[model samples]
Target: MTGLLPDNDLLVQFSQLFQQRTSLSNMQAHWQQYHWKETIKLGFSNHKHEDWKYTSLDRLLQYRFNYAQKLKISKQQCDCLALPLDSHRLVFLNGRFIASLSDNIYESYQVSSLVEQKNIPVAVHAEVFLHLTESLAQESLLIRLAAGKKSNKPLYLLHISSGQTDNQNKNIINSSYYRHHLLIEENAKIQVIEHFVSLNNQSHFTCARLTISLGDNAQLTHYKLAFENQHSYHFSHNDLILGNHAYAHSDSFLLGANLTRHHTSAQLNGKGSYISINSLLLPFREEICDSRTYLEHNKGHCHSQQLHKTIVYNNGKAVFDGILKVAPHAVRTDGKITNNNLLLSKQAEVNTKPRLEIYTDDVKCSHGATVGYIDIEQVSYLRSRGISKTKAKQMIIFAFAAELTESLKNKIIHQQVVTRITKRLKRIDI
Candidate 1:
């Protein structure tokens, strides 16, 4: 196996497995014949590849990986993953949906085992989506929302994996990877919350694929939070497509795991579409957090804004790379993006990049990034008020993360995020 390209063995095995399972034989053959060899032929990692420079997947490959085996989840366990909202909840254990643990809803929405579906919407049937799909293990656990319907309550999707239950935990690194697909139709107002949790302190890998389509006047909000154990690794890919007059907002909170990488790519194809993205990432002591986003305006009169904040404590490290692209025909498009970091200790590290690529002269776009320490004035003021130095520092750190937490829109979720942040702060040494 080449040292440059990570996961060479898995890549080869997945290609063979994908070709045998997929009905799209032509595409599968194309990947197996060309893409597979090209990817694995590389002896060393193209670390300089701008997109991969920040988060080093190759370095992760050097360690042993424990591939989690598929497991069955009982109906009782599915109930625990149900959301507070009027959502259709489904549980996937070890990457396979458990029918016994799911509700059968065929009229309003199609809720069942994801393995039942053989095809996805055109919005998600793209080149990049296909490549990742082929490499990921297990058929995706799917969720399809009907058109023109508004969900009374938000949707909650819990991808729960108990390594002990799978018995594959004894593998070298014990990494588990998951692949799933979701689709939302037109005129639907849906809020989706995804939670990643583990029961043991084993090294794991989780990879998820999400495809969301917003029809005319549709509204959607997606919130993804990661709370994995110390030795786990997570890689997630999300794709969103928006129609005319549609709106979508994304909120993410990454607080756990030794290494976590989240990638989001959105394309605005319709006029009058709008999107806002907000994320809060806090990494502490040996934790590595890497996030990347790509937003494209393919048509005119589209707008997007992104704000990401990172707080690093102890020897933690973080990376943020954001790109906003406006196509040549996308006149009157507007976009603004910012990535900022608050470093709590000298040992903390941060890397931020906000990039803009515009091909249309009629568009307005801006991008920037900032990295710095806590505000001395705020700390000093709290210290003068009889608070201890350590306590004062904690207060300031929480305040910095408040901006991201307050954007949750849901009061309950906002409060939960705050509570989780506070808990992490308490666990760390000031």
Candidate 2:
């Protein structure tokens, strides 16, 4: 596999399919020969690549890469960041599911493996993204949620990555690249809380794709918290489809990793559908964070909103790109997006871009972006109140983060997110 990217296994096999060298009828045969169960390969970058151009992951893979095989986890260990959730718990160690570390029972949802299902059709609307992962990922994890079910309890997902490498006696060390495929059925309502944390100081990378399909009148609430070591890299892609009158809300908190990128896409395919996305990222110590969001109004009477806040300090960098596209026939569509960045140091950097593409004249669409440092007047007023400069700065940072965290519908998850924000604020030397 020298000269062939370790992350290119799926793409390599997919190349054969695209070239007609391998037939769909013979896919099982190829799967047996070139199939990697849990490990994956990344692609080489060219000028034509749209996604990786800004992220620049091509240079990072050349470094010694290590993949984590199945690792053990104890319930008592790494308890400081844990959140109390009553729903099913799914735990992963180095991108592999660790059954011993997960809670098997749940009152609201049933969890099963993708391999266990005999037949499952790929949704037509999600075909493009599915093809991307199928050509890139080595293995996939599937989550199937039943219809018309509502959960007050939150589904907890804990992802633990350790910097262990599988030598495999090869010149290049084995590093695990992870991908996941999530599907929520029609008319289902649920709350999912995902936490990604690094166990040891090992450089690693993660790429994930999630697709959700909402039935008429369905609803969903999603909360994500990511904390990685300063040496690791992270990439994630989210795709959501809304049915007629369906609703979904997503709130995210990002705190760690040297480099992290998030790509989110939501499509309003049915009339009267709605979605709201709120996110906050706090970066320090030279860490870099970037996020791109796409909201498409394919049907009339659909609405969407996006709001993102970022805080950068100590030479760290943050990037935000928000795009809203209204189709020709999607009249009366309403969409608004805003991206705001708060710079805390003279050396810190931020890039904000908000774009709107409208094909319909009757639609209401607006977008805005801003990047600025804290107001000196506000700081002086706080200092005059007998508060030290450091404490005042910390208070201002905490208040900025609380804006996004306050939207969490679940009380317990809201508190957990606040705790993470507080920890990030305390890490700042200012």
Candidate 3:
């Protein structure tokens, strides 16, 4: 629950579980500083909440979740996930960072736990879940790239969850909470790749948040891959802020998860800053995926581009809401937004909303959204080329997704993303 729910039972259970684990004066006092007491009183968001209106949490609220604890899994099993093997890598299992699995690289970047560096910059729109993660997670991963420093390799992160139901703890569901902070100082450059998966391929809920700050002349490139099992629920938020001459490129691949909601907000606050966000949401077999993105141009000479593509099949549903806001003084702001979706079956559907709110007359902004089935003309062309009907459909779907995937700069990561999407498409019912 986001602490906005009417049900006090979960909050009670969570409090009770905390009390039962340790003495009130001991570890129990640790959870209080998170400001959860006030947030819980505010309660869970309903259909009336504008941002959450399209996606319902009723299906997820039926289960009771327990806070995840640290556990060790086999090395062979870790390899099975095919996680990226970057030189500078950090691994977190169930929300707990594993120092043993993390790379001890130094001299190029600064990596510390939130416990040591408590001064984290709060983005503009801090949500209840961000505070909730702070109250529960004792330690969070914090990475800071030294100003004017450039890294030869990308920073890799593996966030995996694996476990069965917590039967011993009153049958509580196993849910994990994780928080990460990234700082790119002035004139610094860095690349980060994050892979989220269910290590055991089991059902669970994951709440995650990533805060990014880019200083003047800094550049950060981020790629996120979410491949949780369809039986699981996952929610995440990305808060990114850019400074003068800063640049950002964010690419996301949403493949699985029974119920997934992702909120991304980016603010270009300094002149000459630029941002490009591209996403591919491919959900199959009754999964529900929702992506909400907001881009704000607060300064002049800034540009933003967003291209979102989704393929929903087997009675699955996909929702996308994108907003581009330009400040009154943000002259010469340029933005482009496009959302295209393909529904394979009659039962599959999508809801898309793309808007532009321009406060100044000196901005150039445009948006377009389309939802429909595959073009019969293209399918027929492929079929005439001796391709099977099923294979032809698959080809067209891949073509639609390739438009965004081809924009990726890292070949290794690009291959991995393409392979995952192809594998998932192969398993979909024709």
The TM-score leader among the candidates is 3
Q: What is the lDDT of residue 29 in candidate 1?
A: 46
| Error of model 2, residue 312, in angstroms | 1.0
Q: Candidate 1 on 257-290: residue-level lDDT in tens?
A: 7888787888898999999987889889988898
Q: State the lDDT at 194 in candidate 2.
A: 76
- Ranked by TM-score, top first: 3, 1, 2
Model 3 has an lDDT value of 0.80
Q: Name the lDDT value of residue 117 in candidate 2.
A: 22
- TM-score list, all predictions: 0.85, 0.83, 0.91
Clashing pairs in 2: 6-41, 7-41, 7-42, 8-41, 66-174, 66-175, 67-174, 67-175, 67-176
- What global local distance difference test value does model 1 have? 0.71
Indicate the residue-level lDDT of 200 in model 1: 56
lDDT per residue, candidate 2, 1-430, as tens digits? 2333345543444344333322223453344233222222333433245544444444454454434456666787645446676657777776566677777676656665444222333332332223343434444467766777776667777777777444453333223434454556677887777788887776776555566667778888888787777777776767777889889998777778878877777888889999998788877877878887888899999989899999999888788878899989999998999898899989998878789999988888888988888887878999999999888887787777777876676787778777777777777787
Off by over 4 Å in 3: 1-38, 116-119, 165-171
Global local distance difference test of model 2: 0.69
Which lDDT tens digits does candidate 3 get at residues 264-328? 88999999999999889987877889987888899999999999999999878899988899999
**Worst 10 contiguous positions by lDDT, candidate 3:** 19-28
